[model samples]
Target: MNIAKNMEAIFVAAIVIASATSFATAAVSTPVIAVKAEASAMQTVTVTAKRLTAAEKAAL
Candidate 1:
C-alpha cells in the first residue's frame, strides 16, 4: 500500500512539473511574422550594368 501511494505521488509530481514547463514555454514565446517591415528596412540593394553591342554603342 505504501509503495502504491508513493507511485501515485510521483506521477502527480511529474504531471505538475510537465504542465508548468509547457505553460512557461508558451508564455515566453515570440510570434513569427512573414512580412516584417522593420527587417526589410535594413536590407541592401545591388545593381549591375552591362556593356552594349558595337552598333548600339555607336548610336549612343
Candidate 2:
C-alpha cells in the first residue's frame, strides 16, 4: 500500500510537470503567432486595397 501511494504521487508530479512545460511552450510561442497573424492581416488589407483601386479604375 505504501509503494502504491508513492507511485501515485510520482504520477501526479509527472503530469504537473508536463502540463507546466506545455503552458510554458505555448506562452513562448504566442508572440510569434501574434506576429504571424499581424503580418497576414496586413497582407490581406493590402490585397483588398489593390482590388478596390482596380475596381474603381474599371468603374471609371
Candidate 3:
C-alpha cells in the first residue's frame, strides 16, 4: 500500500508537470494576431482595475 501510494504521487506529479510544459510550449509556438496602429488606429489605450483591499490580500 505504501508503494502504491508513492507510485500514485509520482504519476500525478509527472502528469501535472507534463501538462504545464505542454501548455507553455503551445502558447509560445502558436502564431497570434497582433494589433497595429496604422491598420486599426488603436494607438493609445488605457486600462484600469479595481484595487484590492488589505483584507483581500491577507486572504490570498
Candidate 4:
C-alpha cells in the first residue's frame, strides 16, 4: 500500500485528536459517575427502620 506523507500526518493528527477527546470525556464523566454512584448507594437502603418483631406486630 502506497501511503502519501500527508496521509501519515493526517493519521497522526486524527490519533492525537481522538486521544485528547477520550481524555476530555473521561475527565468530564468522572464526577458524573461519582454522583451516580453516591445516588445508587443512597437508594440502596430503602429505610432505616428495623423489622417489627412478632410481639410488636401483635401490638399493632
Candidate 5:
C-alpha cells in the first residue's frame, strides 16, 4: 500500500512537471511567432491623382 501511494505521487509530479515545461515552451515561442504573423499580415495603401481637362472642369 505504501509503495502504491509513492508511485501515485511520482506519477502526479511527473505530469505536473511536463505540463509546466510545455506551457513555458509555448510562452517563449509565442511572441516570435506572433511578430512574424503580424509582419506578414500587414497591408499598405496607395494614392494617385490626375489633372482635370478644361471641358470637364467647365461642365462641373
Candidate 6:
C-alpha cells in the first residue's frame, strides 16, 4: 500500500512538471514577430516625408 501511494505521488508530480515545461517553452517562442513588425514600420516611416510640412514651416 505504501508503495502504491508513493507511485501515485510521483505520477502527479511528473504531470505537473511536464505542464510547467510546456508552458515555459511556449512563452519563449512568441514575440519575435512583433519585434520584426515594429522594425519594418520604422523603416517605412523613415523613407517618407510630408512635403506640406515645408509650406507650413514657411508660413510660420
Each model's C-alpha lDDT?
Answer: 0.87, 0.75, 0.86, 0.79, 0.83, 0.79
- lDDT (Cα, 0-100) at 46 in candidate 3: 81
lDDT of 6: 0.79
Off by over 4 Å in 2: 1-3, 30-60
lDDT of 3 by residue, 7-35 (tens): 98899999999999998988886588896
Model 6: weakest 10-residue lDDT segment is 35-44
Span of ten consecutive residues with least summed lDDT in model 4 = 29-38
Q: Among these predicted structures, which one has the highest lDDT?
A: 1
lDDT of 6 by residue, 1-60 (tens): 687769989999999999999999898955665434566466533556657687798998
Which lDDT tens digits does candidate 2 get at residues 19-40?
9999889887445444345664
Worst 10 residues of 1 by lDDT: 32-41
| TM accuracy, model 5 | 0.41
Segments of candidate 6 deviating more than 4 angstroms: 30-60
Model 4: runs farther than 4 Å from truth? 1-3, 30-60
**All candidates: TM-score:** 0.42, 0.41, 0.41, 0.41, 0.41, 0.41
Q: Backbone clashes in each candidate structure, one number apiece?
A: 0, 0, 0, 0, 0, 0
TM-score of 2: 0.41
| Candidate 5 worst ten-residue window by lDDT | 29-38
Residues 8-52 of candidate 1: C-alpha lDDT, one tens digit per residue: 899999999999999988997688669757875798978788879
lDDT of 2 at 24: 82
Question: Residue 5, candidate 4: how far off, in angstroms?
Answer: 3.2
Query: What value of lDDT does candidate 2 attain over all alpha carbons?
Result: 0.75
lDDT of model 6, residue 29: 54
Cα distance off (Å), candidate 4, residue 22 = 0.3
By lDDT, the candidates rank as 1, 3, 5, 4, 6, 2
